[model samples]
Target: MEKVFKVLIFTDLDGSLLHRDTFKFDEIKDYLKLLISKGIFIIPCTSKTEREILEFNHELGLNLPFICENGAAISGLELLNIDLPKELILSREKDDLLNIFKNKVPINLQNKCKWVFEMDKKKQSLVFGLEDKKLKMALNRKYTIPFIFEGTKNDRNELSRIIKKDNLYLQEGGRVINLTDRVSKAKALRIFVRFFKKNNKNVKTIAVGDNYNDLDMLKTTDFPCLVFNDKFTLDEIPIDNLITTNKPSPEGWADVIKMALVKIDKN
Candidate 1:
């Protein structure tokens, strides 16, 4: 394969690319598509389910590869290379993770978690800030369980520590907390990079995100971009060349991305 510079964009969706509340990106739709047309990959590295990510791809009218379920799986890799798999499972099944939590996590800690899937459709929609097909798709999680942690800060810290003992971890996204195996966006990104770099020698990653779930991924990329997330403090996830934008997502996404590309070109 010819070795031309390749930029792989690993972006979170909520609070990063899509509007945090509305889940729309119409403002940057053309910009995203334009980047794709120019051969830049806009890969969603999000805590969302595969079905929800597919809806995103469908809306974009593009068949882009995505890292889903907080990196529980990587799908659409066949788009990158002929020999690569159509889907790669990176974490254990959702039930297995849930079983561990049920048996291991203390009853008090468990009670503090309101599992999203166990909720009625109406409540699920309310917690996720999604409705109709989008809500349905979001619930189709295969490798992770989404839930709301109704615990105090100290209780949450204790729960995080306990889960790590069993090799289960939490991914706190913009909307909810996800329980899963010892998988993360960074691990999935590394796997994708390893597979993609096999034939393609020139690959520079640009990671965009807005929440705790996306921190490690941001650190791993050539250019890291954080969309305006006032709730998150930047000092905690600091890294060199960390690009940021003042506006919120749907617009901040495009802004930081453009900044990253300019830096990529200059490098």
Candidate 2:
């Protein structure tokens, strides 16, 4: 007989799980709890800082491990008392990455982009569409530096080229662009999947996202979901098993998860 596989759902936050503007998951709170009760592990794989992801974990009462800073770091295994093969961190430290950005990026390009941390509370609130308190939490970076590019497309491309020369990269999310070390959500997911399958030979992974940064993670999962993002649409991903939700999240998030759960049960 074939062994039954445990299911793990890895999700992006900004425009995939939380409402892009409000940043609330109230609409799908119950469904989330239902998945947890059904023994599905919901891991938030996001560009969000450790502080922000912790806040969400506390709010949702999820003790599972999480991927933070666009796969720069992973934590919470100690909470679950699970020892892994190795540390799950993939990117350089936040300050180190920032130092590289500050040194490598040209003064001209630096002036063209508004570094998020340089902005005051009011300006951050306006740019991020978050309240003062939430913006404070969002700025707690330990790996990635989030920013808004105020330059033209050509300028942004040029800036990216310069950053790449130093082995760094930019990831454009739903609301902001971020600079970080050579790490990606997909790389972190692969590490976690290996650890998970060590305990359970049969395991299935699900990934959901709604933006360019999420492309790699979405492609890496057995079940891939493309949530609707009004801000940007993803190009066609060459996954044989892919699902696109009808509406944007948190509605789309709930819908896709429900569909995945049903399919998992049937299988």
Best by lDDT: 1
lDDT tens readout by residue for model 2, 106-181: 8988898788888888888887788866778888887888889889999989999998988889898767899889
Candidate number with greatest TM-score: 1
lDDT of each candidate versus the true structure: 0.91, 0.84
For residues 30-53, write the lDDT of model 1, one tens digit per residue. 999899989998899999888898
For each candidate, C-alpha RMSD in Å? 1.8, 2.0
Residue runs of model 1 more than 4 Å from their true location after superposition: 1-3
Q: Estimated TM-score per prediction?
A: 0.96, 0.92
Clashing pairs in 1: none
Error (Å) of candidate 2 at residue 223 is: 0.4
- Quote the lDDT for 101 in model 1: 88
Q: Score candidate 1 by TM-score against the native.
A: 0.96
